[model samples]
Target: MGGKVVFKEYDPDQLTFLPYKLEELVPQGHPVRIVSKVVDQVDVKPINRKYKGGGASSFHPRLMLKLLIYGYLTNTYSSRKLEEQAQQNVHFMWLLGMKKPDHNTINRFRSEKLSGVLKQFFSQIVQLLVAEGIVSLKEAVFTDGTKIESAANRYTFVWGKSIKHNKEKIKSQLDELWKYAQTLAGEERLDTSPTTFTEVNAERVKQTIASINAALAEQEDVDPKVKQKLKYAQKHWTENLKKYDQQEKLLGERNSYSKTDPDATFMRMKEDHMLNGQLKPAYNLQISTQEQFILNYSLHQTSTDYQTLPSHIDGYEALYDTLPKAVVADAGYGSDENYCILEQKGIEAYIKYNIFDKEQKEGIKDFSNDSLHYNQQENYLTCPMGQRMQHIGDGQRITTSGYVQIVSRYQAANCHNCPMRGVCHRSAGNRVVEINHSLRKHKQAAKERLNTDQGIKYRKRRPADVEPVFAQLKHNHGFRRFLLKGMSKTEVEIGLLSIAHNLRKWKA
Candidate 1:
């Protein structure tokens, strides 16, 4: 059978639009009302224009503010785009009260009010969530750190101004380019024929070299105080110039250099590069969530995961009244300082250290004699060579419900003649190797978490809780790179994106 014909027009009146209200679609007692309420409380008296004669009119600050915020929540960050959508999209139309706002007006509203407005909105949301009982301060919460990729590339990276010495790399590149330019310039009877390229291109190469060298020379002459800035400028200039030169040189000979975005950086996704491995520049987004709702998110330029924990915790606590009850994190968040901080906070934290090797240094495990085991409080340890270590003077000791640490030193004389010297002693001869009293806290926690039913539930729930949110933003929402520069702006961008994600989730 043949296909049936179908036709459609862009007429609005002929369509029967469904009643899909944004306000009605959202959950009961959503923070949108709180947003409206808080915005109502902001004073617009100062913004009102006053004539010399008498009273004056005031622009609707609240309406414009609401539109801008709703725009952010919907991921319509571009002011022009927001304005276009406001006239077209039903939700945006309703939010903006069917008024056609110019793109410039929208931009001014966002740029002028975003800083203060976002903070106010965030505080109100926190307060509303607290009131709604979505957050519980009494339960244990798990925490993890993830690196946020920055909008800027590392090549744009500027460092502290230092002019101690010259680098041979720059010298080498300059020398090579100069030689190549000289060679290109000297070419006579340049081949018009593609097959017979006249005497290797020297003059072109020479010009290129001269250009690069000039940039280098300028950098070298810059004042020591301003050398860093000069270096950065030269680096960027030379790189861009080289790209142009290479493209022009290869013209039809090769494909044009395809770096359309200079802000992008190559991010390594895996430790080892396999055949099918992928690499791309992406923002490392860090998010903190509660009750399946994202509380905070931040973007950073960190390549490592170690440094994001403390600051994130601080940010969360500052934004919200209380911290999550029990902080659960992966091994990346595990550090001596973090452990100390968690303990100090009186929070039950479960951060796993990535230490898998559990081999005993010596036969110290066998040294737990009847006497040693009986008096567990004393500061003593067993040596690998079946010898007991006793503390000489006042030494520090730590104890937990699971295990006690008895740190002590072995006699150098006794360790010297031990038959199992290689395993027990790492030094040249009889030397005491101070051993930490082994505590089974980590082992016990791991075992219980993997075995117990509650632990199993938490483990299962964790990945589903946070991982999908990130996947949605990155995959569905086209939020891979940032639109702003610098850490503070990046943080704000992240916050907006997070707000957008939550709003979408709520809408869905």
Candidate 2:
């Protein structure tokens, strides 16, 4: 033994007679201290009002809220883990005042009492942060969307496209089967009532099955082939039709949804480790951030960020009673409708259009025939080959949101004998282009704004402001998948996470 080690103290059974204070155990400026202080400041009257004075005495809403928020902050999202921490962890014991609420109580409080009030709680914490001078509502906000996996099973997916295709096939088969039945009866014995296939649903399928059964029952001497066909329709077609209808209902306005968690849409998640476009049940979590702090967040069933922008800003307005002075987002959010909305609301839009990035390349501009000079007075464009592209008739283009965009058509005078035909027009006919003047104007205005110093500053700060919060939530806190099901419960859980994030930022 090299220089016999001297132990300062060792005691397994020696116990102190003095009482220990829980508050004295936690150090100053710790994150748990911040959580306790923030929870103490939040007004829980709304949460308190939800309780009816009938059941056994329950844990105080304030105490439960603090424990849940602290648990989320520490990456202890599971109710069982939280219960264990309450009994074992000193920090949790100190936060709970040595009171250990079982996992059932913890879960019930989170799933039931905390369901609708989470938005209020989130808004209150944001107000606190605003009051503390940590963030400002008037400042520009960077908005982005990420897909978080839902608690729903990955295999129980319902695709809208598949439902539509199968429904069409089933309709064709049913029509053929009905015709065969009528021919077999020789006098149109089967009912000729036309069924509306427009909105095929389980109820409608059930009615169709009942009608077919009644019709078959009325037949005194049915042919074997006709009977076999009718029975086949009842068994095979009925089940498929019902499935398609259920899928259609679940996928109202969305491309896909999960059977377990109907609110969660199946989207291509970035978590695919094999670099394949594997679809998983997930929710679009759109968050607006300022100065690395999450100012607001929303959950959408759609994966695209464009459609979520308007609703996201609406949510922000609902929370703070006013929209931000300016909104900054990437090209995915750039659309004519969004630009129009921002303009109507008098908010500066630092958004980029689809071609905003591509236009930055010098080579692209050289071959981009659309960038050629246009004579508005003559209503024509000059091609790169010094050819006059004559004005054709105007056409209307309908957007995904049903907004009609008017585009003036233009065609090159002649491309048959041009030396630069290979470089310019590869079409057999004259080069045709459609120009939406209004959308062009919006893009031009956006381009001008995006070139400004303030716009550049917003762009530079966007990734830093919003991306890190996601990293902290997903990587640091291990919130890759939601613990709760349904949109409402997921929203509540995210609200808790956001509150924890803001509290941590405040502590920092």
Candidate 3:
């Protein structure tokens, strides 16, 4: 015989209604409950002042902020999804006190009202975390950067190199056209001053066009070729010249930027499922984390991690009124300029340079190359074939950051008949190498620090402190691509994500 079975009864049309309280629906120690408590403690007076007194009633800023934070915590980034959840999800309904806001209202609040004020909100939450002892400002920070793909169209990328190349071609054609016009007029009609083609901007191109028209105005019998060239220049070159000018203005120091989102630069993104190196519109997101909690974050257009360190440190200082005692980062953030900046700021740098790992291998270390053996007192380098490479000369190198680096050039005595010539260097003549003394000194100092006990501890804890935050953000939250367009809006989106991450940490 089968065991006695019991089934629970359900009636959709039952008239009995129990007294339901939203607070009782959520249990204590729930993430949503913790989010509610934390949002209640945040000071929203600055956000409140953005709204004027006379208008139709809108959702309270505090309520909207709480809704947005909770939405992100639950991995609901889209406004439409959040709107749907607000009407259906019990936790969201409880957080909003059963007040359902439409998708447009949520998006408007995020983009328009909360655009400039997210920094304050993020700081307040961090300060609260500090007060709760979840974060330590004196602890060492683990810094890293990742490219977050922008919402801009990837095909509309404008590269600085392409612009320069095309501009030169156009300038050459225009110069030839000018010479042709001069030959037709039998005199130097346009200004033939000694100016480089690089100086030929849209205004100068327009002036040249006007000069050709004025020169051709008086002549009744004009060459058909010259007239045809003039018409072609006016039709084709004017718009391109103007467009290049605008693009140059947009690309001040960046290599490339997207047209739809001008502040987002084109960077090589990690490949998709097809395994191709796809260049997409992205922003470099630099974050400093401790114990897997994001202490600070800054957005940059520069693709490299090294260039983002100084400004990132500055932003941290601006937020916390002080800097971390020590910063731990991988080799990507290590550069001569970065070391100099960290030394000036009096922060301990446990960073690694490009060749840090390569020098650790046995084969590379046993090569006995000239770069490895340098006699400071004798000012000479010993080649792999036991030849003395003498220091030939000294020179000055100006870095991109305007710091002058002193470089010493070393040339092998003779490599023409050396036994190890093919292995050491494949050049027919003596090999020449330049070493920057300033950079070498900084690298030696960094190496010494990296070998110390405290440095080892920081190194061991770095991956634990920072990498999981990115994993949680990208993998757990499914926040791979940005939903917003401009830099400011993207910053707000990141700010919300950071807040949600911290709150989730706090709850855990």
Q: Given candidate 1, what's the lDDT at residue 62?
A: 69
* Model 2 bad stretches (over 4 Å): 1-4, 187-190, 194-226, 367-369, 386-391
lDDT of 3 by residue, 1-508 (tens): 9999998998878775776788888888989888888889888888888888988998999899999999999899999999999999889999999999999999999998898888888988999989988888877899998889999987898999998887898788777766666776756555664333545777777778777777677777888877787788778787887898889899988889999999999988763644688789999999999889999999998898998999999999988898899999999988888998999998999998888767656324544342558889999987776788899999997755566778899998778877766667776689887887667888888888988998889888998889889989988889989999998999999999999999998888
Displacement of residue 307 (Cα, Å) in model 1 is 3.1
Model 1 Cα lDDT, one tens digit per residue, 94-171: 555567778887665544445433644554554555566765544655454343344554333211111101222344
Task: RMSD for all candidates, in order, please.
Answer: 14.3, 2.9, 2.8
Report the lDDT of model 1 for residue 435: 40
Query: What Cα-based lDDT does every candidate model obtain?
Result: 0.51, 0.84, 0.85
Predicted candidate 2 versus true structure: per-residue lDDT over 332-443, tens digit per residue: 9998889988999889999989988777664246446457788889888888878888888998888666668788888887788888878775778888877887778788
User: Where does model 3 exceed 4 Å of error?
Assistant: 1-6, 188-198, 213-226, 363-393, 398-404, 412-422, 426-430
Reference-based TM-score, model 1: 0.57
> So what's the TM-score on candidate 3?
0.91
Q: What TM-score do all the candidates reach, one by one?
A: 0.57, 0.91, 0.91
User: lDDT of model 2 at residue 416?
Assistant: 88
